[model samples]
Target: MQRKFLDYFLFDKKDNGMLETLYREDETSFPPFDTQEVSFYLTPEKRLSLKYPAGEKQELSYQGFRDNITFILESPFAEYFEILGSPYLDLEVRTGAEDLDLFIYRRAIDENGKTVVLKGNHGEPMDSFTRGCFRLSHRDEVAKDFDKVRVICQPPTPKSGVVPGQIYRVIASAHTGLNMFARLGHV
Candidate 1:
């Protein structure tokens, strides 16, 4: 399972080193988390349909995209809280661009407050409408406290309804991981 989990984004030399440092210093490591994905049509009507992955990779739709955002915001996952406090990943996103410099770093804390930071390499944006995976460490041996990464989509303020063709931003953070999918996704 460790090797299989490592195969996704760990093969790259940079990712490999990050993983090594993570595992070496952290006692509890977590597997990746994925949302149920659907397909989004780029029409004016904003059509969304469900899609089941036949093999491995999953496709995500736009309605599914909206639902995902709501779930992430509303869900009480530990990762969400952790991310809120960390210098995780904050991105100024531009759709269909490859020059996004996304990175993560440990936040600094003092009597004043917390300070966010950007670490090593800023990741390039994958193509549009793709979910970015965040790898975070869990706290307990049972891995109850988990870290998290998230993509934040910020659009121009809506005139009436949610605006279209605006912009989406991505930020990643780690707090605690959520067991939302455990017990057959019953959470």
Candidate 2:
């Protein structure tokens, strides 16, 4: 999604430093999961829709799911905020009545056991086609006391998509550490 690191600050996760996910100039293949499906697809509208329900009732599409993970790891905000490979990234996927299981994954590997995206310390920008405006919500899905920093997004509601309603509480953790003037400087 489009983002600007308004304020500059260094966040140390202590010994647990974050890892970044990279995007490739060349289109890469999707990852594989053991499942039977009709078709897995991701649209330019940032909507991910599949033809039919795969055998995994509790899970989302295998290949296309990876694309979303790829988008998040490569998002500009992720890079600017330096939140790539932390303990784990919680991506609140928005789907149309679909319960899918996705991961930040240590590496991007295809079904054939070949590495597609390698693990690294640098975050990459998400492809323009798949990126969009991201707004955070007030409720924290993962508790603050938890060891990992979980990034949560609203899943697409059947009626209005994934966009949040009024009273959205943006991620305040970063804002608290940033100086207002420094943030304005970036603007």
Candidate 3:
């Protein structure tokens, strides 16, 4: 039998703060959803891997100093998990050039209705690829609120010049155990 699945935009605060239902084909009623603990593991190997049900993995090369390298995380389950809590993100940089930095950001919509990418207030860029678990939480008072985040990997600065053909291998994923509870319903 084909498995039934639900699609939810976990952290699109512009539309809804926590949960935004995507679609429901059946009229089956589900219980109320609640905040739950979720965890993620991102790894780089023969292929990228995300532990979450709808997570995604990608591979790309840096386009040199003139371009910004970016990765977007729009997982269907982002809203239900909290970075500051038990749920977290694991980033593994398997293969890449030295001196590369990774920056995290939250995607937000401004008053002007434009989509703005806000830099993470988490501190200095991750300068090592020693396989570490990271919390993508922002604690700045002035920082805007957001549900979803993106990652940017690039060289230190333009002054250092970009490596002509540098390629990076990375994996990112989230794993939310079934011990958590949630309001279940159809969109």
Candidate 4:
């Protein structure tokens, strides 16, 4: 029998309002998997938080492009996460109105050192609770070793359409392994 390991980290408004992987694990040494890091600013009321972890690799460069406003997750062991029973990274967004759209992309490098990107398919618009989820698996076997997940928010194109001083809350969570079920049964 093989021993399965599941690791997960939760991000919230606490801890100085920053979601980061720094010091959470030793990246210099051999790590079981790559740790996802996110740096952002949180409002005093804690209703709004913005994170931009994609850095120079950002693909969206339109007229309203804002730096450090997107979210990125770098996962090198995505296959393991799927085998453990938790394959998707779930993200929940809350806003004052229903005028927000989420764009998801997966970027990875193939064996030839070429870049491959995949876009997500969002069906219907979100209702009261704005939510979206993306898979970590890659379509190309050569680039299946790891995955770069990007999450961006598309505000209403018309400036006047958006609510003034509206607060947006984004919550990200995932089930790492089978242990999650065990913990639930015990509770």
What are the per-residue Cα lDDT tens digits for candidate 2 across 1-187?
1222221124433232223422432314322232222322333333334443335433333354345433211111111211121123223344332232232322322334343432122334221211122223222433243334343334443332234223222222211111111111010
Best by TM-score: 3
Question: 2 or 4, which is superior by lDDT?
Answer: 4
Clashing pairs in 4: none
Q: Model 3, 50-112: lDDT tens per residue?
A: 454444665444443456433333233323322322222334332234344444433333334
How far out, in Å, is residue 180 in model 2? 36
Ranking by lDDT: 3, 4, 2, 1
What does the lDDT read for residue 25 in candidate 1?
A: 20
Task: Supply candidate 4's per-residue lDDT for 9.
Answer: 23
Winner by lDDT: 3
Instruction: Indicate whether candidate 1 or candidate 4 has the larger lDDT.
Output: 4
Root-mean-square deviation (CA) per prediction = 19.0, 18.3, 17.3, 19.9
Instruction: Point out where model 3 deviates above 4 Å.
Output: 1-35, 39-58, 71-88, 94-96, 110-113, 116-187
* Candidate 2 residue spans exceeding 4 A from truth: 1-86, 90-92, 108-144, 147-187
Please give the RMSD of candidate 2 to the true structure: 18.3
Q: Which TM-score value belongs to model 3?
A: 0.27
How many Å off is the CA of 12 in candidate 4?
51
Give one digit per residue, the lDDT tens place, for model 4 in 30-57.
3236444423332223222344333342
Off by over 4 Å in 4: 1-98, 111-113, 117-162, 172-187
- Local distance difference test values of all predictions, in order: 0.28, 0.28, 0.30, 0.29
lDDT of 1 by residue, 23-68 (tens): 2223243332433322222222222212321354333333322333
